[model samples]
Target: MHILVTNDDGPPSNQSSPYVHSFVRSLQAAGHTVSVVLPHIQRSWIGKAHIIGKTLIPSYFRPGTLHKDDGVASHHPFEDGKEEWVLIDGTPASCVQIGLWHLFQDRGPVDVVVSGPNYGRNTTALFSLSSGTIGGALEAAVCGKKAIALSYAFESREHDPEIIAAASQVSQKLIEKLTQDWPEDVHLYSINVPLRNNVAEAKILYTNVLQNRWTTGSSFEEAEVEEEVDPAEQEKEIREGERNGTNGADESSVARRKQKRFKWAPKFTDVHESVRAAGPGNDGWAVKEGIVSVTPLKANFCHVPNIKGEIKLSSKTSISGDQILASSSMPKLYAIIDYPDPYVQPLILSAIRSELKDLDVELISSVQQLPSPASPLLQYRDYESVDFEHALDQPRSSLLCAYVVRKALIRKHYLSNTISTWLVKHPQSPLKTHFKAAVNFELDYAEFLDEALVDAWDLNDSMTRNEARGNDNGNKEWWILKPGMGDGGNGIRLFSSMEQLQSIFEEWERDEENSGGEQEEEKEEKEKVHSPSSGNKVPTSASYGGTMTSQLRHFIAQPYIDPPLLLPSRENRKFHVRVYCLAVGALKVYVYKEMLALFAAKAYQLPSHLEVDLSCHLTNTCLQDGPSREGSVARYWDLEDTAHGPDWKEKVFEQICEATAAVFEAAAREQMVHFQTLPNAFEVFGIDFLVDSFLRAWLLEINAYPDFKQTGQQLQDPLIGGLFRQVMKVAVRPFFDKEAEDNDSQGSSEMRLVRDIDMGRR
Candidate 1:
């Protein structure tokens, strides 16, 4: 395969991204054609940002002629022409974009786009989304090319070229093996490795992205002492004459930039995986064990709706209620759909690169960027973003991206958003009407299962005649209100009466209206100064009630759970569980074996003071983990610790599995009609569940994207590092498994029963 490698960490002239040359050599050693491009300076933390309408001047390093210009010089290849390894000064994403459209336009379709070997890891959702290493790969996927994002983890911040050089061959081998039978709907693989001299050979671990984050932001401080700065003489310098190219960076400036004596303030705090959410199989855990973590990620976000499930009634029966779609050995045209969501990202992609045995197929995307031959004869398989029209011209015939499902405007919130609560105790799903909730019961917190009483209302809704009558019981009733699209307990309020709820909504809506269309004043923001006085604020230690909240999208109302369970280990603070589930093609569901337990930021209490203490009712980590909140330090514990010993623990896990399976089954039954599976498609959901005082788990919120601003753990790489490996095996690897030629027979009968909805044939 011909590979083009690039990075946001730039040009050889600056000696940045010290591993680029070795990486290119390794690609050549593996018998693959390689091309390279780099920015002029380091561009870290710039996620998918592009320099549009601006020309970038990239100065190339002249091999064999070392001048006192920029940096290193080495003999690689294609140096006779100015066109090789086009070093354009641009963003990482822009490099990939330009390489595909302009640089490689005459070289034919690029077989692969490899980005990074970045200075640090891009594992957690927070870091990965912000990393140029990942940004490049995501851009390639966006443009319909096979892409790989690579990162190396190390204790030392200094770049280690020898270690990177040594790992190059290993990386090629592993990447080659992983891409052998890549899937259709899946498109990207994120790999992270730790460099250790003592370790000889390393095994790769499949894992999920750790949902973790940093606790503090950077601050400037006065220098306490003068420190020595490294001279730029350590790096080799080369001069080149290219149009719009820079001659070299100033030696004094470079020296100053590398200084170690600068004083920085407000030391950063240690990372805290959202309390109660860490598991042994995630990326953080894998890195600690010293292994290469490969996460299969996708760029699609859609909720599949429609499933006509065949129900089989039974108590504790391990039987399925749906008829399996029979497999047939038939020729099929392949189509792919890719939809990228800004905040919600896939940890890895499972798209394979080749055809299965006796399978005549061509993989393609709907986007019109790549060069296509005139009247092609191969079976054209097109992969495209959600908005484009496929070449097949058959609506719904194309396979959607691995993480996306059949989505409709109204169904978006109803399935995975706040209203997801309706599914748990859905009136039409099943049960003795015990599934009752406001607009949706499925999304209700486990602790609030039976606590749901009031129906959901809107801004236009008013008091009914019966409500106007105001019975004695009505006055005593209380309510919990939240947004259908919200997280971290941002907008939450506790209400004592309908009148109060209305008043609060009015105020909140007014605030929203005033702030909705406003843009950030970047110049003004940068000009503001922070001082000790500004940091100080009046202190308080009480929870209050009455109309108060935010997250004002679609509001959900429920009766407050009376006397909810509180963790004894956490000063009687309320908490809940955040669980994950895999719904393969919307046919079946598989729940993770572990869960996170996020504790409330503050002690449990009723609204008493003037503040509506969101930390008390909402257990989202971000809402309560900050220093601004008054709590006994935010914490999370594994659910294993919460189980009632071995035997009872088994029961608890089994119940969770069954409940989760039942919920997805209903979703499938209601959503199958709208599903158009084409051999390759799947979805993984991060569904949060909460357990009440009665020890019952209620499905609370369904998060479409896995957010790591809080739960991402401190490990070698990010969390998806290990989790995505499992996803590949379970979700996208079988389509090309000639050995498992008869595997389709085991689709619905498999132990996990992740519904494999092959569009036409398997």
Candidate 2:
């Protein structure tokens, strides 16, 4: 996909803004075609002002070619298809305008726009007025395209080099995830990454803007001096000579030309009253507390008045008493006994009970026994139910359950199967048939394996791991490997030699043999064997082969990614992304709101190959090794260091929405098929992504059912509650209508029978 990359930092020629280069490079790495446009000179804080009545001309900036000491060329200019740099002698906002109007015109409309790694925080009231970074993003938003403004705030400028480098890294990760998974509604995002060595340890706070103003100290000072002749008279004489257009050797000219100097001293006054208090839980608080704040600011801030009018209640509104009676008599919804897995069953039951309270619900083993659950309100013994017998007779009962649900929902008109049929017919709705089929949920790994091969062939190594994971302690050679499927670094083991692998395997075998027994008995035996306090317990090196070895079934070997550098003054840091997504066209709004912004201490170190092998960038709270690990699992808002102070929750949501939008747009362009399905039929999805030190976003996994428990609790406010209620209202209304209609039809028949019996008795 074609992307326009610009920043307030200007071009690469400017040493002050080095992140622009890295940002462009990361986009290219993600298979996006990139074009860079930036200012020739620094124009910091130039908010959204544009040059009027002046044509913007592109110019070349030669900061001089960078080269090695041996005279080897380290950089060269692009001659034809690509340019090393294009500089415009205008504001950052002007640069974005030129790119959109001219540079991207021939290539078709730009998909997404990214702005900055601005030097400081842009929060609270300053956000709307932030001309430097937000200006470009606002320009993009105005153009009806999604945009993001990235920034970094640090305690001191001394550590800028390290901070800039880290910003670039994390920025890349953010861009990747944003371009691939963000939703369509979000127009723009403002992201602020706090500058600290322990970036991985940095907490991501979704925050609101802090409207606090900085206090300015008075430059006045107390002084006693003899009064001098009025300087105003001298200035008037000089102005009179200039107006007369005379270098006349007259008295006035002479007086005007005379050198006049006075001591310019002012007494220093006390600093202006501190304007620190803006509002509660603002971005300033988060930044002060050492957290990365992400804020989503809406383009429009108008509050339209609600005109009062006559309240016209809908005709369909049923009488409260009648509706209550009907609701009470409604059929009890029973839980389908599909999966034997105890884990999922309870969750399903909980959801059902919560939604269908007062309705009878029972667990039935099979279709034939479905009618055995005695309830006056509900009954079932139909052919469709009998079809379950054939369905469950399959290899995977879960798939069978999905199929049955799909069939039932379709039959009852709860969902449209027509779209599924259309998809089958067209096969190439948005992307090529193969790519479309590959993304369809029903098509399993086996079906998509061939398509995966084709995708791999087309993309080459782009789809593979970008870099070998770096090891901690600055050692590049020795590394700790990790399995892809293992959670919490469970299957990870050091592999300095083949002997270690063999020994580990042997130990695993011994443990397996010792624990083997009947299913239940074996489970108990294995649990005892792996217990932490077991007597004569195996050492770390020896325990590697036990359950850990088995956990390596689906894994990837990698050199451990390094932990972030630690600075003494800052809070311990860690970062993770909770991406929410919905199907492209599915109905029933699946809003995956809220996220867990987790963090861990700098001292809470993971082992390395040399020292027990846990040093890595895997920031999952479940993976952290420390006594305080349990507290790492926090709601995004709670992750803020209250002592230091910013409430970053709102800002984080805004950033997520903005980044997610950019990602969805980019993904649509790159993977056209999935894009076509978006913002329509689907509701929402949560994508777990990780940002590396370089700011490059890496896709961790796509969760169909992103846990909403934490989110529901975090955003327990009325606004969120209203949104939830709105969506639920839309989703279940049809089912409720169907129930009402059936009740009406049944009631009419019973009354007719009653009348007939009365006539017969007379």
Over 4 Å off, model 1? 1-384, 387-398, 402-436, 439-477, 486-490, 512-553, 607-610, 622-637, 640-649, 670-680, 708-711, 714-722, 738-751, 754-762
Task: Estimate, for each residue in 202-300, the C-alpha lDDT of model 2 and write its tens digit.
Answer: 666556654433233221212224336444443333223322322212322122333443322211111011113444345666665666666666565
Backbone clash total for model 2 is: 73
The positional error of residue 169 in candidate 2, measured at the CA in angstroms, is: 2.8
Best by TM-score: 1
Q: Relative to the unseen true structure, what is the C-alpha lDDT of residue 743 in candidate 2, on a scale of 0 to 100?
A: 36
Q: How far is candidate 1 from the true structure (C-alpha RMSD, Å)?
A: 21.9
User: Where does candidate 2 have its weakest 10-residue lDDT segment?
Assistant: 753-762
| Runs with alpha carbons beyond 4 Å of true place in candidate 2 | 13-15, 61-83, 106-108, 159-162, 179-185, 214-280, 301-762
Q: Could you estimate the TM-score for every candidate?
A: 0.45, 0.32
lDDT of 1: 0.48
lDDT of 1 by residue, 674-715 (tens): 333334344556666566665655665566545433443221
> Residue 685 of candidate 1: its Cα lDDT?
60
Weakest 10 consecutive residues of candidate 1 by summed lDDT: 316-325
